[model samples]
Target: MKIALTTSGENLEAPLDRRFGRAARFLLYDLKNRTFELIDNAQNLNAAQGAGIQAAETIVRAGADAVVSGHCGPKAFRVLQAAGVAIYNCEAATIAEALELLKDGKLQPAAAADVEGHW
Candidate 1:
């Protein structure tokens, strides 16, 4: 399965970015292939509105099966849900740790948006 993790850096060791929509980058990891791709999110970092929606679109376009992030806003949540991409909230310190928690089934799918949209 492919998982997209919101992060501040390009590698697995990077600290998890708590803000999903304005995250510095997204590390898309393919578990089966053990490969990863880093996608920069600079464009959305300073977006006045709709950052979450744009971020959700990015994840969908990247073909991610799930998204691991600290929080999900209403607009983003709906977008991801509509696209069939599961959203999991994690407080893990690092991207790699979050992946482990997911692998161990410790991470649970979010039931609803955890944060209000900025717009």
Candidate 2:
């Protein structure tokens, strides 16, 4: 399985970026091979009204089976689900920490988002 984690830098010690759409980099780990790679989030971070849809697309294209992050918007979450990728809920501060949680099955899918205020 390939898993992506929102990260702030190129190393595993880098803290997790809470803002999914605007994250700095995505650390991808291939469970089968035990290898790590970084997926740059430049485009999504610079997009107007970025809502994570692009991020999800990037992850899907990179062949990730799941994504771990602090939060994700509704549209992107749905897109990821449609792409057959699972979402892992977490507030991890580093790549290693996120991977540890996942290895321990400590992360769970977050509930779907609902409106919290009127427009």
Candidate 3:
């Protein structure tokens, strides 16, 4: 599975970013190949509005099967859901920890957006 993790840095050891739309980076981890691809989110990070929607579009374009983030805003959440990408909550955790939770099936797919737009 390809899991998109909102992170502060490019590596698995990086701390998870609490804000999905404004996250500094998104580490795309391919479980099947055990590889990581760094995606710089500088554009969305500075957006005055619609950052969440932009970020969601980026994830979808990257072919992410799921997203692991601390929080997902309504617009982004809706976009992800429409794209069939699962959303998982992984606040205050490292990328590695988040992956473990996903592997163990401990992370649940979010049924609804956890936060409002521009959150």
Candidate 4:
């Protein structure tokens, strides 16, 4: 499974960005091969509107099977859901920590958007 994590930097040790739409970067981790790749999110970070939707599209394009982030807004949540990509909440944790929690089945799949758009 490929899991996408919203982060403040380029690596797994980076802090988790609480806001998915404005995250500085996204780390895509392949569970099968234990490899990771960085996805730049600079455009969405400065977007005046529709950041969530744009970020969601980026993730979809990168082929993420799931997402781990602090919060997911309505627009992004809907896009991901429609694409059959799962979303998980992982607030206040580093990318590495979040992955561990996910692997351990501790992170819960978000049933709905946790925050409103433009949050």
lDDT of 1 by residue, 4-103 (tens): 9999898989999988899988999999999999988899988999999999999899999999999999999999999999999999999999999999
On residues 16-77, what C-alpha lDDT tens digit does candidate 4 reach at each position? 88989889889999999999999999998788999999999999999999999999999999
lDDT, residue 13, model 1: 94
Model 4 whole-model lDDT (C-alpha atoms): 0.92
Can you give the TM-score per candidate against the true fold?
0.97, 0.89, 0.97, 0.97
Best by lDDT: 1
Model 2: clashing residue pairs? none
Per-residue C-alpha lDDT of model 2 across residues 5-87, encoded as one tens digit per residue: 99888877888877676788899999889899999988776677644878888889999999888777777778888988888
- The list of candidate 4 runs beyond 4 A from truth reads none
Better of 2 and 3 by TM-score: 3
Clashing pairs in 4: none
TM accuracy, model 4: 0.97
| lDDT, candidate 3, 17-104, per-residue tens | 9899899989999999999999889998779999999999998999899999999999999999999999998764799999998999
Which portions of model 2 miss their true places by more than 4 Å?
A: 114-119
Q: Over 4 Å off in model 1, which ranges?
A: none
- Residue 116 in candidate 1 has what lDDT? 87
lDDT per model vs. reference:
0.94, 0.81, 0.91, 0.92
